[model samples]
Target: MAPHPPQSRPSTGPDPSAIDTSRRPFVLIWEVTQACDLACDHCRADAHPARHPDELTTSEGKHLLDQAREFGPGQLVVLSGGDPLTRPDLVELIEYGTSRGLRMTLTPSGTSSLTPETVHRLSDAGVTRLAVSLDGATPDTHDTFRGESGSFEQTVRAARAARDAGLPVQINTTVCAQTVDELPALRDLVDELGAVLWSVFFLVPIGRGRVLEPITPDRAETVMQWLSEVSDDAPFGVKTTEAPFYRRVAIQHRRDANETPTDDDIGRRLGITAGDGFAFVSHTGELYPSGFLPESAGTVRDGGLVERYRESELFQSLRDRDALRGKCGACEFRHVCGGSRSRAYAHTGDPLASDPLCAYVPDGYSGPLPEGRVSGD
Candidate 1:
């Protein structure tokens, strides 16, 4: 087999411009199962306790891996789920994808199943990286957010075990009204865990997450600005999940310090919007531009993923930065920070609408602004 692509970040980010996103996604997320042990408040999947009877079979999973490889070698495939560990054939699937020249990553629920043996098994199976969520620094807050009594401990243990097993660990944190207060402490925890990356996921109200609170645009602005400061010295790389304005904030921060971004910087921090550089495949085979953006392009059961992603109207609309509406459409950083399509759809029915969470409003644009305008303040 071809050696796996060398990766500097857990996300395996390559130069975004070199890759033709119209034909292939930078990252493909496959929800292997919806069956999970934890009931996370912000769970996009609204995961089930038992596996769906119609969940893709092991053979079907191999076929999907084959389809993923069609994107080209070194395609990043993240095996996400309610908890990937629930799937007994997860390792087999990872091995198969790795053999097909896909850079395989896994996001498993932190539970009793995340033992050292399980981590070692995943490492031995050619899994490129392991991402575990740690929303809060303390057990009380994190466990409460997860709706489990011991999930915090399990998450910490699993991250440590993954590190000991020679697996690069990435910590996924939720940023919202409920958990945002703990971010500073969680940053310390991320450093303590020796994580390679800290993926701060700004919450999008979906499913169980609908009941949870999203931070206001001003609050998000403050947080992203602070995170920009944190990234300056944090050992691990930092990326926001649903908030692309962090890129805008970072760029502005650097420029304010009279630092001009190099050519490498231009490609490394691309804002991968829904249906742009990212794609998601549900457990039932439906292909979405993003898990948070439920607008399905088609199902694998009906058509090939390549056709849906490349030629579908929805994907096409999302990829066109010019098609974006309101402030996002006029923003100078539109291409580099296209805004979060998922959050845009959640706030406005139009997937091409501007992300309300971003406080930046481009100058000289007279269109109606987002609800909370930190406009020129």
Candidate 2:
């Protein structure tokens, strides 16, 4: 099927460029399952091949959907998993969530289950968009990284099928030391697949992800610079995940090039950072600041997700940029670029610690180093 004309960029809420901080956290990522066929090297959930007996049932899923509605309308509930498609009741769950006034999206590990018929069913079930991961530009590299031969082919086929089914498609690519060099080719593939958005997720060491080495701070800065330059001409909108500091880098680049930055630019800077504007619910119903952070705030079984989000000290502390440690706490762009809490926690065992992969030294930071500095002493 020929790619459908690109639709206006899809967002869970109002244009992020004009986001209201008072009404933050308009997105909830729900891990619907912990079972997937592939054993990706960077799988954050450490998924198994069999569904956990304690996974949420369809009734519990419906209750969760009802609770999610309390976050307000236009809120995006991203149903993700080891592979959400692994669940037979996925379509039923999607329909249930959407029927309750929540906009839904899906993030499925690309596998045989993502056939054209499955894509059509998902579309019919009210999924606004589908995000599929593509880590490498070539099959050999991607397949090996996924720990499943033929995964690359399946992913490409799924992307095509999703578009053919008239479902908006977003391609998520992980950027690490290994895949950094292949981004240009991956960008080409994204364009070829006619994806509407390309999300670049910088590696955060956690679960199975701890085994893969992340790129150095200097290399990360260089890659962001490259992304900032090429994004202007790319066919799809570009965003970064687990790398909120890219906003500061992008704004600085624009200013260096003599462009006047606007409040919209700054407001748009508030991407899905942990606790501030994002929430994660595990398959077992445990609530977290983010899927990456894995710090439990509460569980859906206790009920009142909105209350738990508001009352959790962890969430509150995360939202308070002044509580951040090291360079991040002292950075002039603290509000706009709070750095990655997950990466900080992974490297220094402190979620409030400065992200080690960010090379930008804050403007007025001359204080003595924090006790467990992940960067240079």
TM-score of each: 0.93, 0.91
1-377: candidate 2 lDDT, tens digit per residue: 75323222224655655544335466788999999999999999999889999999998998988888877776679999989988999988888787777888999987887788778778877889999999999999899889998889988998998898778899999988788889999999999999999999999999898889888877888888888877778888888899988887888876752344453142354545888788899999999988889889878865868877777888888888989988898887777778999888888878898988888775457754434343343
- TM-score of candidate 2 to 2 decimals: 0.91
lDDT of 2 at 83: 93
Query: lDDT of each model, Cα atoms only?
Result: 0.86, 0.82
Candidate 1, residues 339-374: lDDT per residue as tens digits?
A: 999998997888889899888877788877766663
State how far residue 377 of model 2 sits from its true place (Å): 14
Q: Where does candidate 2 clash, by residue pair?
A: none
Assess the local accuracy of residue 138 in candidate 1 as a C-alpha lDDT between 0 and 100.
95
Give RMSD (Å) of candidate 1 vs. truth.
3.7
lDDT of 2 at 184: 94
